[model samples]
Target chain A: MTASKDKEEISTYKTQPAEILAIRDLTDDTRYFKLRCKDITMNKDFQYRPGQFVIFSLPGVGEATFSLSSTPTRRDFIEFGIRKVGSFTEALFKLKKGDTIDIRGPYGDGFEMEDLRGRDLIIVSGGLGAVPLRSVLLYIEDRREEYNKVFFLNGARSPKDMLYKRDFIAMNQRQIIDTHLAVDEDDTGEWPYNVGFVTQLIPKLGELIDSENTTAIICGPPIMYKFVIQELLKLNIPKDQILMTLERRMKCGQGHCGHCAVGGRYTCLEGPVFTYYDVQHIKELI
Target chain B: MSKEKFPEFVELIKSKGKLFGPVKQKEKYSFEEIKDFSELDFDYQRTIISPKKFITPAKYSTLRFVKFGQTEVLPDDEPQIVMGVHPCDIHAIKILDRLFLGNIKDPYYAKRRENLIIIGHSCLPDDKCVCQSTGTDMVEDGFDLFLTELDDFYLLWVGSDKGLGIAIEAENLLEENVSEEEIQEYVRWQQERSSMFTTSIPSYKYLADIIHLNYDSDVWEQFGEKCLSCGTCSLVCPTCNCFHVDDKIMMNAEEGIRERMLDSCTLPYYSMVAGNHDFRPDRTARLKLYYTHKLKEYIGRWGQPSCVGCGRCIAYCPVDINVITVSNALFEEVCETQEVCDQ
Candidate 1:
């Protein structure tokens, strides 16, 4: 079978140890994690784009996919904003600071930052969608001179349910990017931003920038896609310029596992980030 | 090799390693370890399961772990010779090799594949066989040795160095030269076998386009209504290599072993996420994925359909949903008159 000298095989399934440097609660059910590779050499060499994800293996509990909430500009540590939703998350929540876990990848076709350079950018995130968008937001913030006008619109169910409240408020205070925060309802009445759906903020952008030079990146709940895309289209933003990150149940982050397959593509390989023009024909894609 | 010398050739193969061949049990044929040459049966049209079970397996432990440390459990490194594989199954194995042994090599599958040797046997088509349509009726390679049975002798084609080694070992039993009459006889046998195929998908070449055009057709729902969701099609198919992994904990809660087993896309919750979100919630969508992935999507990725037309899905599906019926329905776009769409 060994007919010719074969290229070195890339071990897709192998994982390295990543120790938890810190763990902080983002909300009642969600937590923000900061981790670094246990090996010093691996820690320095680890590189990933904003929209990529990692597979967190808990050994006996099995493995699950999580997005990298931290940007690559911050090379010291990797982060994930995980919600306690299922059995895997339930076990993950029990782990304390300084604990170690098995992680692999940086998989998926993340956002092409270089492609979006010099283009007017609008980043819209809602609920837990902020997790992945946070990475992109921080990436843009570090290299603010590369892009044109940048806008960050974030939404949550209420004040208490919002993730990264402190960090976003600080960014809003800095006035570097046009940061807009919206709450579905201001139950506490202490909210300082708009008290309606985040889709309402989309119209405010109509008068600020030229739609032809603009690119909109959105990540939100399944229901938010229809309204957000409709508003973006009304503003004359091109369909191909409208990018979104998606979620799917994945075991192997590589293309081997069929769990993330949609139509003819795999979410773990071809996507997690797709243009509206690319998936508009797919009926199953939201 | 003549018919009388076949037993002696079999003995030579047995001396190499553990040999497995098709055997009849309970009126069904399966590949089982051969204890004696008399137990070998080569007349079967198809086995219950394809030869994929020998490589990927239905279930196997991938990693054994304690509380803090883990180690990969590689398959044992013993030479294995599988005899009597057909052309369609050989094509299916090639498809698997492309997926598992391609850019990202699966260590477990690679090890098992390297250790196993293939010995192919020619087959005549039955009513359910559609290999002729799928273009997998004849395998040019992917086997150590290929045997085409003539009237009085077995014309052995050495496909690899391993096969050449075996041919060298049993040189006395093999005919050194092909006679003029024997060459004509082999050509005639090939022509006769080619004409025996009774089932075919006429528009198989354009199946990818046809399936894409009819993605929203009602034919899938009709098939879905009758499907039991028992995952029998995937278990029997040679190219269906999707797997689900589970971690088994010890009774003491100290250690566990992660096991991977064959999974089917048509089964419930095949695309479900952690937060109870199911991408393919209903049977119709899941069933559509199964056919589209094999017949349409595979072509886009691999330049050919993954279905080699072994007829296992035709023989095994309780609801009569097979590649032939599904492809024809999509191609014609007329499922209203079929038995499935009548309801």
Candidate 2:
């Protein structure tokens, strides 16, 4: 994998192979690809601010950008949790563990964790939006001492659809982090946790929301962003302090391709991670 | 320097190798080999596409990847000159130069660009063209040679040594002792013609500030309603330099070439990611991005406006979603001026 340090200086040309170390099926439609650098070990140490994405490629097929699901601290291997929604992701799902594919970038601006220091971090992720937020949560975990309190509230379509279940459960048991898992329905009764839309759990986490130094980082389907952000606002988090990641069809991770732009900002370049204050005025971004 | 004869200029270029110029094709014009000086079409507005098609072809082999124990790289291409380009298109080429040849320096575009000699054609304004507003009415320097047609004579300015060489070889067709008044008159005429060709926008400096302040303005919905999102505006635009790269291997799977092609922000799939996360998931966001980038962000960086007002985008858009019209609308709303409002 070739990781670009400066966001705008990236060229749309280069591509390098990343060997898939593991592929675990999270759900019928969602799978996790554990990738290890083949040509460049520098990418292993590739530090990306949370919410940034990497361009993953299948040679001869095509390339697609995916948010880094693993924290920057996990330098040896990067993980991508993808939902089979389109041709490229569907093709990626067909690849086996040993299969090698081209990878370019850890492109675009990721979530700004610097300002959240000494603050309560509220992570609200819906569906596969958890993929990018996963990186942020892991980053906070790596430096748990710096942060006040970290609360993770993740919502999926159903109990079966939740990702990183084992890790989430283990973390919850250790109480190293406060974790809330909400499902649209408790159909299989497999999950004995809080059940409902993720937004419902927001009101119940009183201390996490009431804290003055609270910062909410949200990523999810458009509908989820609307309701989740609405909840955060009700809790009176400053607009600038609320961070959200947007999903766009990014052909080139660089700013050159007009794709991935929300108004004047290229989501792949200027942001995938944006403060509510920055995007509040830009309509239809949700 | 001294002027050279026109016939000698043609002969000199012919001696060097093949020379290309705009040739009249039906009612339109296209870049083709020049057999004689009369075949040149100086009246053409803009080509079907910018000259970018030459450097970065719609489909060209980027590099060949062969597996001989390990992967081996091979490139495919030769160099050629592109001549008789319009001032607006020349400006577009310069934008591409900044993108493809500046920082990263794409070997493909850089090689072809180095091989090419740009001969800019002075714009004699047409109703469809607005190169003047874009500040490209007459190029100061992006070409090897620039030509302006006078009454029964062609005024040639040698911008590079290659152009001087051509002028020297074309000595027989040149006339000596041309008056300074004639050159001044030509420049004056070009300036006057340019002023008439432009479609005014608000002050370029205030563009970003205005857009940022008016982000919630209802103008976006108005423009979005009219925008077809066919991407013609960006495709024809001189400064919209976004592109996508893909790798295509032969059926044998042993070898392939990586290809980079122009991509437009207007396309829906341009921002679509693997996990179904669409950053700018709606048409309103996309339309707003195009205008702000051209009028706001680019202006913020370059000081000058990103768009050169080469009306090719206005001319080629299927739905007539001209940037001039949209910008003027925004300008009127922000400045409350009747002048831009009337446009």
Model 1 B-chain TM: 0.96
Q: Which tens-of-lDDT digit does each residue in B214-284 have in candidate 2?
A: 67678887888877878888776767777777778788888676667777777776666555556665676
Q: What is the lDDT of residue A167 in candidate 2?
A: 68
> In every candidate, what fraction of the native interface contacts is reproduced?
0.67, 0.54
Candidate 1 per-residue C-alpha lDDT over A125-154 given as tens digits, one digit per residue, 9 for 90 to 100: 999999999999999999999999999999
TM-score, every prediction: 0.96, 0.85
Q: Whole-model Cα lDDT per candidate?
A: 0.89, 0.72
What does candidate 2 score on TM?
0.85
lDDT of 1 by residue, B55-134 (tens): 99999998899977998889999988899999999999999999888766888898999988899998889999999999
Q: Provide the lDDT at B276 for model 2.
A: 57
lDDT of 2: 0.72
DockQ for all models:
0.62, 0.35
